[model samples]
Target: MTDTLLPESDAGNTSDAVHEDRLWCDNGWTARVIKNEDDDGWAVEMIKDGEAEPALVGPWTMGRDKKNPKPLDIGAFNTLVKTASEVLRRHEQQLHAQLHKRLTVESGDGSVEVTLDIVPDEDDPYALLTAFDALGEQLAQVKVAPNFKLSRAGAASWVENGFRRPG
Candidate 1:
């Protein structure tokens, strides 16, 4: 078979997709068709480059012979890439929401923004509780447990207590 060349932008993208019968790679994603472990069918796995786990995996259609898996083509590969990219995006948004939180509360002086940023360290997981005034000037910051809950009542209490460490 003739060797296919990628565009200039994708030429620099190493480990890219190559169109094949059961495998396709491009757009920073790889799609591989394999036998479904749970049944006598085929499955497609889409994995983003540099990621250890596949972003998406689902059943694949059978070929005309009705025994073998369908071949990977440009249209199918593009669709797989789009679906996998969406999965990664949603995952990142979820992780960010889990690791960071913010709340604004009214204090004696004015409104204060309280934020909790969690650091998921393997050995020493922790979170930082920070207070900022209306002018965006930092009022106080302290290390707290990663599970620190940032709520309106909690933030108001912290600001009222002179930004002391939450108990």
Candidate 2:
């Protein structure tokens, strides 16, 4: 019932050989086992290529003698890569949500949609607020503070005041 994604030669090496605690460039990812600072257990970090930081870090299974970390194999490496990829994807989605927000307001003629997009730059952080009519026509666009809050009341006020920057 065991399934393996790597070639037979690679799989054989992982199972038969006694590998070191760290591996680099194995199956498009790298894994490192480090002593956990918070506890007596060991931790494993999985880092993908071209990434500055490890995408996933978690507890490592102990060896049969219960001292060193269990030798990493193709199965474990594949699983770690899958988990780390998911973590990075979720982090990106969360970051995107934090940078963009939208609100709809009822106007005299129709509904107006307001979108706030934050540009996070270490040197100069700023945001852009844009308004679109019901037909998706751009009504107004202005630069605002990065921490600017958008709401139905704010959108309505902006439209009522001739699309001028809200004070």
Candidate 3:
């Protein structure tokens, strides 16, 4: 894509500075101009690399600096896009790690399967634990606290209770 250059003002350096001709930086995010197929003015889109999609999108005002905005440009838009993408990538990774966890332990009777499922919450992390029979039948399910470490004694006890304990 062709990059548009913004006219320099009293803002700062032009080399590393993000050109405000087309976009601006707010809170370390890059905002750009996109067609607002629905309305007038323009639709501002916040892009963060690695994120599934844009972090934010809304109507934006132009030349609103001091009195109004100047314009949008390439350098400024690129910077904001990179920052927003990083933020999104981190959030996505965190969710993935919390939602899926699997562990397997061998026992005297058979094998104990331990899985930790992270439930998203605004308060604290929550998880679920399930015990399965050797045949993969669901035996029991319990609500487990976040970061709960599986204990060997518990697995051993479950096996002992189900079958003969080794002497």
lDDT of 3 by residue, 1-167 (tens): 23444435523534444435455543345566766668645667885434456786766555554333435555546555666567778988988876766555677657767566767677986777666667887666667666665556654564556633222
Q: Which candidate would rank higher by lDDT, 2 or 3?
A: 2
User: When superposed on Cα atoms, how far off is each prediction in RMSD?
Assistant: 2.2, 5.1, 12.0
- Quote each prediction's TM-score: 0.90, 0.82, 0.41
Q: Say which candidate scores most in TM-score.
A: 1
Q: Is candidate 1 or candidate 2 better by TM-score?
A: 1
Per-residue accuracy of model 1 over 52-141 as CA lDDT, tens digit each: 999999999999999999887767777888888898899999999999999899987988999999999999999999999899999999
- Candidate 2 per-residue lDDT over residues 1-167, each given as its tens digit: 12335666566434433334455345556788888888888899988768889999999988898888887766677688789889989999999999999999888889989999999999999999999998999999999999999888887899888888877
Error of 3 at 62 (Å): 20
TM-score of 1: 0.90
Q: What lDDT does candidate 2 reach at residue 2?
A: 26
Candidate with better TM-score, 2 vs 3: 2
Cα-based lDDT for every prediction: 0.87, 0.81, 0.59
